[model samples]
Structures are given as C-alpha cells and as structure tokens.
Target chain A: MPAEPARRPTLDRVLRIDQATYDAIVEHARRDHPVEACGMVAGPLGSDRPVRLIEMVNAAGSPTFYEYDSTDLLRLYRELDDRDEEPVVIYHSHTATEAYPSVTDINLASEPGAHYVLVSTQEHGNNAGPVEFRSYRIIDGVVTEEEVTIAAAVDTNDAAEEHS
Target chain B: MAIEVRIPTILRTYTGGEKAVNADSAGAGTLSALIDSLEANHPGIKDRLIDGEDLRRFVNIYINDEDVRFIGSLEAALSDGDQVVILPAVAGGAR
Candidate 1:
C-alpha cells in the first residue's frame, strides 16, 4: 500500500484578521493614546473570523485603565445578539506597557472564546513608529499567546449571505 | 414569578450550557433574592456572581437594560418577565 501523506495542521491558535480592521485598530489606539483604547470586533456566531470593528469609549478615561461604558456595553451586546454574532476579538491598548495581558486583564477576562488583542502605544505614543501588537487567549486565568496573521482580506466563505 | 436570567458564555458551564435560565422570583423582588434562587437551581453559580454580599467588581448585571448599579445594586427590584442579563465587565489597563 502507498504511504499516506501527513495531514496539515490547522491554525486554530492563530488570529486571522483583515488588513483594514488591523489598521483601524492601530489607528484607534493611536488616537486614544495615554488613555487606553478599547473595542470589540464581532463576527457571526461560532465563526472565528472578526469582520466588524466597533470602537468603544473608555469610560474610565484614565491613562492607566480602560473600560467600556456600561450603557454602550449593553447596547453593543444586544446589537450583536440581534445580528446573530459574537465578539470574536476584544481588543484594548496599553499606553505605557508592552502588548501583553496585565494581571487585571487576565482576572477580568470573561470571554473565553475571544481573541484578546493588545496594542501597546508605549514606544510611539501615537507617532508613526512601530507599536507592539499581540494576541492571546485568556481562559480560566491562564494566558496563552497566539500567532497573528494579518491578511489583506479575511476569508468570508463561511459568512452568512443575508441578514434580517 | 419567572425571571429570565441571561448567562454569559463563560459562565454557561454552571447553567448546563443554557444561554438563558429561569429563576424563581416569587419572593421579595430583589436582585439578591433572584441570585439566591438561581444558586439553588444551579449550584456554585452565586459565588461567581456575588462576593461578600455585593456583585463581583468585574461582574455587570442589568435588569431590563438598566444597570443594576444605577437601580440599587443587589437591592434592585425585579418583576415577572423582567430580563436579567449578567456580563463581566470588558475592562483592563496598561497597569
């Protein structure tokens, strides 16, 4: 019998985001530098792809902390539910730290299925320099760093065709 | 009274994978009482929802789209068919 070919490994741990969303997230971080920007990218329920980016206001409005406005949070979730979508990526910025999950981030992580993307504006402070962009899966207080693949266009083959 | 409690994805394990569950609301119409009734049906869930008589700092609970904090925290009143949604605050920082 002929030898069977080895199966290719799936890139489940990698976050495959689109170029436009990526640029927008970086822009948001820069625009709100020193106050910590926050937002969510939502996609179809059960689909790992992040197709929509919704920038959120940092209710804390502080240099060291960021929180989505409570009213906005509820409205966002309701909107997602109405669209039959889920938060595929919950992203935030770190003004003075590296692109990594802080202790508070790990403790407050409630969405185990989301890709926690952290953008650090420390090096540039909204300037035209490189910023650290990283992704992680924080579940049950454990942080697992993941690969991030920024594609010119994310695959939308599995997306629903129509919305009511 | 039947109060619908919406559970966030991470806490669905305590609810046997139910997106929403029914909790008894026949007694005093307080959020605390609703949580206690929920804990009775789903063991080990109140701890995640409450801490030492207050809602956990990171946990956000809303009644009929109104934040519990504005309504009265644990003392927030409830009525039959009032939607109770619980979501952990999406928050963090550079520190």
Candidate 2:
C-alpha cells in the first residue's frame, strides 16, 4: 500500500462583513487616532454574520495598547446573552502598526469563534486617503489570516416588490 | 460540582492536549482556589497563569465571558457551572 498523505486541519478563515459595518469600523478607528480603538460586533448565535457594530472605548488610551472598560464589557456581554447573541467579530485598530495581530493581541484573544479584525491607521490618518484593513482567526495561539468580503445589505421589501 | 476551565492553545501542553478541563473547587468556591485545584491536577500550570500572587500582565482570565480583572481578579467568587477562560494578550509590533 502506498503511503497516505497527511491532511491539514481546516479552520473557518473567511469573514463576510456588510459595507455599512465595515465603514463604521474604519470610522471608529480614525476617530480614535493615536490611541487604539477596540469594539465588537454581535449577531445571532452560531451565525457568522456580523450585524451590530459596537464602538467601545479604548480604556488603556495608549497608542500601543487597548482594553475594554470592564463594566461596559460586562454589561454588553450580559445584554447579548439575554438576546441570544454573541460577539461574532471582535475588532481593534493599530494606530502605528500594521493590520496584524501583535504578540499581545494574540495573547488576548479569548473568543476562538469570533473573527478578530485589525485596521491599521499608521500609513494614513483617518482624514487621509487609504487604510489597511484585515481579519484573522486566532485559535490555540495560532494566527491565520482570512479573506474579508464587504457585502451589500439586501433590502427585503425591495426584493419582494421586484419579485411581485 | 466541577467548573469548566477553557485553556488556550499555548497552554494545552499542561492539560495533556485537552482544550478544556473540569476542575473541582474543593469547597473553596473562589477563583484563586479553583486555580490552585487546577495546578494540583495539572502540575506547573499555575506558573503559566500566575506570577507570584497576581495574574501575568499579558494573560487575561475571564469568568463566564466577564473579565476577572474588573471583578476582583483572583478573589472573584465562583459558582457551579461557571466557565473560566484564560487567554494571552495579542499585540502586533516589532518583536
């Protein structure tokens, strides 16, 4: 018998974020320039879709570090739990670094199921032209970059009318 | 009853590769006690989670999705069926 090839483990590494949600994240990052901005997006449990955008404060208020206010985080989690939702996407911005998870960021990823999004405002200020946005899945101390697709929100009423 | 402790990938080696472990509070019912029991079962795991008396600066511990830092840290109370999660902070920059 021939030797069998080793199969690589597969992970959920693709993120589909709506255009509006994407823009809001960028705006938040720009608004908190020189200081890291951190927040999360909530959605129905088990749904990979990110529907709610939460703009959180940078408790650390440092360009190199960011932490969520403990009380606010607790309140948010409790609210989401009551509504049967979870943080589908946890995002933060890098003011002076690239859109990648730093060693510190990798260490702080608590939600293995949530997509970790990073936006870098280093090259261009929020008022300037370009920004670097990226997403990744940090599981078991491993970081894997993923594809981000900006999807357009579908209007259910418009769709129904067109079909009619 | 045993509390569930979710271990991060970097520290799985201490748990014999188990992603999560059920730890008995042994009637202490406190976060610190829970950690002590965990160390008793999985030797050397306490050092990774704690440095001296306080949690390592880079490590974040959460109880049922709430950060322990804000809830009295190691002194936080624990209840049956509570979930404890340990994660390292991730920051991107020059090594």
Please give the TM-score that candidate 2 achieves against the real structure: 0.69
DockQ in order? 0.82, 0.19
Q: Which pairs of residues clash in candidate 1, taking residues 3 or more apart in a chain or in different chains?
A: none
lDDT of 2 by residue, A1-164 (tens): 11222112134467888889999999998988878888888877666768778888877788888877655655676577577677889998888878878777776676788888999999876686688888888776777778888889722233222321
The digit string of per-residue lDDT tens for model 1 on B1-67 reads 8999999998999999999999986589999999999999999999998999799888899999999
lDDT of predicted model 2: 0.78
lDDT of 2 by residue, B20-80 (tens): 9999888888889999999999999999889899988767788988889889999998999
Q: How close is chain B to the truth by TM-score, in each candidate? A: 0.96, 0.94
Binned by DockQ into CAPRI classes (incorrect, acceptable, medium, high), candidate 2 is: incorrect
Please give, for residues A4-36, the per-residue lDDT of candidate 1 as tens digits. 221121356889999999999999999999889
- Model 2 residue runs over 4 Å out of place are A1-12, A154-164, B1-30, B38-49, B58-95
Interface RMSD for all numbered candidates: 0.8, 4.9
Total colliding residue pairs, candidate 1: 0
Return the TM-score for each candidate structure.
0.93, 0.69
